[model samples]
Target: MRWSIPRSDAVDVLREQLRKQVRAPFAATAGMVVLLWASLTPSLMPRTALFQALLTALCMLAGYGAGALAGWLVRSCGGRLAGRARVIAWRVLAGVAGIGTLIVLGLSLRWENEVRDLVGVDRVGIWHLVLTVLITAVLLALLLGLSRGIRALGRSIGRFVGRFLPAAASTVIGGLIAAVLIYELAIGVGGNRLLGALDSSFATINQEFRTEIPAPTTPELTASPASSQAWEDLGRQGRVFIASAPTAADIGEFTQEPAQQPVRAYVGAGHEGVDIREEASAAVTELDALGGFDRAVINVVTGTGRGWVNENQAQALEFMWGGDTATVSLQYSYLPSWMSFVLDRQRAQDAGLALFDAVYGRWLEIPEAERPLLVVSGESLGSFGGEAAFSGAQDLATRTDGALFVGPTADNRLWSRFTEEREPGTPQVLPILDDGEIVRFADQPEQWDLPGAWEGTRIGYLQHANDPITWWSPSLALECPDWLEEERGRDVSPNVRWIPGVTMLQLGVDQFSANSVPQGQGHQFGTAPVYAWAEILPPPGWSDERTDELAVVIGDRAWLR
Candidate 1:
């Protein structure tokens, strides 16, 4: 009581306390900036590209400014909710926010007719999505609470370790332990549920929409030299659909000779959804049985949610080759391809390796003179996985005769590498590599107008400029990709412009809407498959007229999704 400070000293002490109080919001703002920067840096910032780096820096700064604004908002509202009245007010505010969110979601559901058409579902499914979001939010809150407890446990351990070790070291160890615990919990509990919530309702309805295919009849299987023992055996071997070339009598007027009849074999990934490798092995064996050695074999890897090969591509190959080609494929996953990639990319990659390896192994056994030219093809997520079979152009050249990956995802490693390392003046979407020798990217067949006869094993990627699958990436949240500046795909809206975060969010929505348009005309590549295949494997007697004719036929035919 006797130790009274001087007035000047007391004023200084008060100022210090005020400064400390003011520091809290600024510190929080700094932390937010760090978090957002760390999250976005991996996607936005490329090591070599100057524009990407500069743009990423700007994005980081913008995020920091947002964080600052949030900090100010938090500080302004800090002491408003203190007593009983404040508590009640908070409850009212939360209720208002919830109602507002629901209203917004309802409006969105009403506005997004294109998404409804694309997904081929009704309002009930949209309502399910709303429920999914709410449930997911609740689960996330629970996880956050659990994480807090875990973090406390980690801190307690750190305190204990502090007695035995240096403070910095103990703190680091504790943080690492906490991180590991959180990661394990995320995987062990939340991973499956989180993924399922994305599209489970839609997938359920989609599965219901699939038509039940009948197994091959005894008469059909035993139909003389025209009937394939392998094709008939597929029914017993558990394939979903086996469409062998119809005999002369079966096709009636449409029948060309037995030599011109193509063999198409496909097996489902079980209605129950079993292992991919086993199914792939089974598909390879079926390919072998169905005269794969005698025909130019195209082993296609079907996208997730697709139960069959790209019918147009397969049919085009058969048509171009005069029925001297066979296509084999198997279902890998039941979830929609976009969802599958988000949930379990490794499965797709594994399927690609297993199927390709099995076919290549079998293909090797045949004598060089008699061995059919082996080719690989895939589309969308199918392309992403199929590309995993090769490390680069050299690897592709050595492994397969020719390959076609249509609508390739931006993350495809080989595609990215090739595009990045292409010769100068080459466009990002359709890069001409090594004078169109090893591999070339193409938006259309006309871009492949190289001088003289094209040399080397051909691997073409057909990515439409407008395809969301080809361009969507986390980086779009910050900066535009080069593809946007160059010639846009025929279908892409001219009004489409890159607006940083807005564009990113818009494209995410566009992914759902893309399927509303007809295939080939949009991302599905409609009649483009016939043209693409013709370029990749120029069959004997193939002409522009023939390709155009087949394109028309393929467009007219119904294909299984």
Candidate 2:
């Protein structure tokens, strides 16, 4: 029922197809135009020349493919300009693309400087722009060459198959086969190997110590002289966490009153043959030994992938409660937060649920009146894990005295639900849910103060407007988020425009530099926890001035570790 090409004719057809595969000059010009537009688009953070080059090159490649496909479709539909008209069209497009690219580059430099000013970073010079152009040219050439090679291979397969089948059938079948082979080789096997290599490398790094961070000697800290957990057993981050706790002296000096030593218990992921539940149990044992349950406040904190608890969050509560606090955490993975967010997110959820349940069960054993105020906290991927332990806002409010989740990832179900159901007229960045009765979101310290009488179990989410961790979603490739459509956040550039797939790429690259900016912008939450905790559950007689003073103190000493 199907006609197949003869072997000799198929060879000739293949040659013609390969020859015609060469992209028209107009296609490159179209790509250049799109590349310029992508370069000028505003991002969450001010990018370095290297990052700018990468962004532009990637967008240019996408544009080139699109333009080439459009040309192919036009030709297939029997559309063609005459010799003189084609030449004129090419010249006009070339002129427009060239002039447009130069103008956009000039505008991009100004926009970059503006972003730097907003984020309090140093500005880039004209050299940066020059470097971006050079690097982009190199990257674009390499990408185009690779793309052409892949296309050629696919076409060759189709041509070979055309000797035995119809042209359309051959092409379709060849494309499908090539796609499957590429996916299997590149992702199924190569991706797994790459992840394994990265995991091994990061695991090695987790065992090493920072030059500045020595193991703790205090009895109240885990991995100390009197502790059951060994110093060598604690991973790098766990060691840093134990060593960075505020001492009685540090808290006493700030409060101008005698302070108790804060209890800190951490279980590392590096322990051999131990599951998450056992790790959590060991943490509870350490907490019990350190008299954590006897403290005025107990924080069941979730650490990021490398077991990094924000010192600001931990020390803020210590200083606020005059060191009468206990904080416990467990490491889930050796890979950094970003890597674990993609590969090992389920481990984080398991760790959070196990640790919180273990601690909550112990707390329940004590008399209701004698129980300390239990609070839950985490940041970024940590927040994603922490939210998994609870079903929704009601579960969080009922189970814990208060909670402060900072820079929550877009995957956090409770956070997404709250943001989606936020009151009308409220912005997505700083949503006011249920009139701030139980749960609230804030971009700054001052936004915590809501009107009317505050009720039970206050929960707060500290999110920056430019925090890519909180805003990035897969849906970004197709749909514009409400945050971009509404009145922009104070830190976000007004020039930011969402361009379907291009905006997704922009935000994807933005994640790398999220924490490179100053404390208030991007993913950095400097001194925000001090105010967040103050509003959630301030100590007796706590005042705005006191919160201000503590913020200053913590800002000075928090990053010492």
Candidate 3:
């Protein structure tokens, strides 16, 4: 029983098994081509070699599947390569794959260095490239093995069913059964369990209060002793926001003038019995209690999934207005922004509509001339939800005094409409809708200075050209975007090109690293909001000089954060 095959025989058998697992010559060639394309494409942010390897592997797998399906169809229709021809085909493909991989790896290293230099990250070396290849090979082997295992199971089922039915019918039935099983395992049961676990984990995270962020003692902030909302009930981000409000003294020091205490009202999703609509109503009530309606300016801010209001956006408004402002927001989900963007989008829409409608309804009750200047603002996923409250540019102008939406997602309805209808000569990155009469897009501070008399309520969208949140789309898999077709953004690499499936994977991966770069690039807005607000809702004596001074202050403060 302990006796076994000789060592050489075992090695030979293992080698033969591995050789059999290799895909067909044509399919392998197709995968090599896709791998080269994916590795060579420019990314929005500087990607580590590990991420690049993963992206290339996934794209190669897709190409291999497509090529294999094509080969199967051809053979089924009575096409075949003879023995000598098949051997020659394999030889040619081997040469092509080897040469192509070397060339692509070299080019990828250069491109990666270029992007790293642009974003101020360290350049990768030969070791990273070696790691990339090793990881790619390992990932490809695992993925291919899994797929082949599934195929083998299907074939076995087909053989059993063939006993009772025609060969073709049995094969079809077996495939359908396999597909159903995969769906049930991967999505129906597994997906629900995974989501449930994530929800519970994030919910627990929301309940935790960090020692660094203490409850606000000021009457002007929510969850204070003078406020209606309980301190324990505010979620983690809500507590941070409430504690981060600029006091009257803080604003006065910056403005060099007397200032009022800024009003900040927030409602957390951690409240047990409060629905979103009720939370919205409670937020308005908190704001009213703090005399928010009496302020010179009022901003209804739509927060990201976990209710994170941007400090840059909020503080810019407060400082510029001498703390004569009120900012209000409500938490809607416990998930992080990206997960909520994919899974809880409908909740975001509902939260945005509810909060805005509730606040707007109450604002209308005041006499038109006596009401505070109303405006709306959001960033990233928050921008996606914020846009849901408005139909288009005209709805924005009519409903509010001003707006500043930063890093808008690709699915933002109003943003897409404006970009689509932009003036013919303008590029997609900085589109000018209706000749910048109302809504306008800006990347730099100076782009706000468009010609003609800027009239009515000003609405500005601050989007960085390299921000994947603003550029990623499902359409990227099949079609080229205008941003890539036109001149590249100031920060984006000129080498960036559109490769059907490869570009989509590049951008999708880019999102994970978007915020790691310096401000004014990727998804970070930095002091751009200071410049945008100066245009959107400038103070009585606001000037370019003042905006410049404030930008410096904001930049300095951001470094501390």
Instruction: Tell me the tens digit of each residue's lDDT in model 2 across 340-453.
Output: 888768878898899999999999999999999999999998888988889988999889999999999998989999999999999998888989999988898889888955
Q: Over 4 Å off in model 1, which ranges?
A: 1-188, 193-213, 217-260, 271-273, 305-308, 487-495
In TM-score terms, which candidate is top? 3
> TM-scores across all candidates?
0.64, 0.92, 0.93
lDDT of 3 at 2: 100
The per-prediction tally of clashing pairs is: 4, 0, 0
Q: Please report how far candidate 1 places residue 199 from its true position, in Å.
A: 12
Instruction: For model 3, name the residue pairs that clash.
Output: none
lDDT of 2 at 359: 96
* Candidate 1 per-residue lDDT over residues 428-453, each given as its tens digit: 76677778787877777787677645
Query: lDDT by residue for model 3 over 1-561, one digit each (tens)?
Result: 698999999999999987888835476456656656665567888887678778877887788777777776777789877799988877877787779778888888888888888877788898988888788889978888887788788888888999999998898788778878888998789877876677777888887777776677888999887799987787888888887787898889989999999999999987463378888999999999988999999999999988889999999999999999999999988889998887667777788888999999999999988999999999998888887888888899899999999999999988998999999979999998887999878999899889965788999999989899899999999999999999887778999989887788889889988988887789988899999999999989998999999888777763112
Where does candidate 2 stray beyond 4 Å? Answer: 1-25, 160-165, 210-214, 271-274, 558-561
User: Which candidate, 1 or 2, would have the higher lDDT against the true structure?
Assistant: 2
List the lowest-lDDT window of 10 residues for candidate 1: 39-48
Whole-model Cα lDDT of every candidate shown, in order: 0.61, 0.87, 0.85
Global CA lDDT computed for model 1? 0.61
Model 2 quality (TM-score)? 0.92
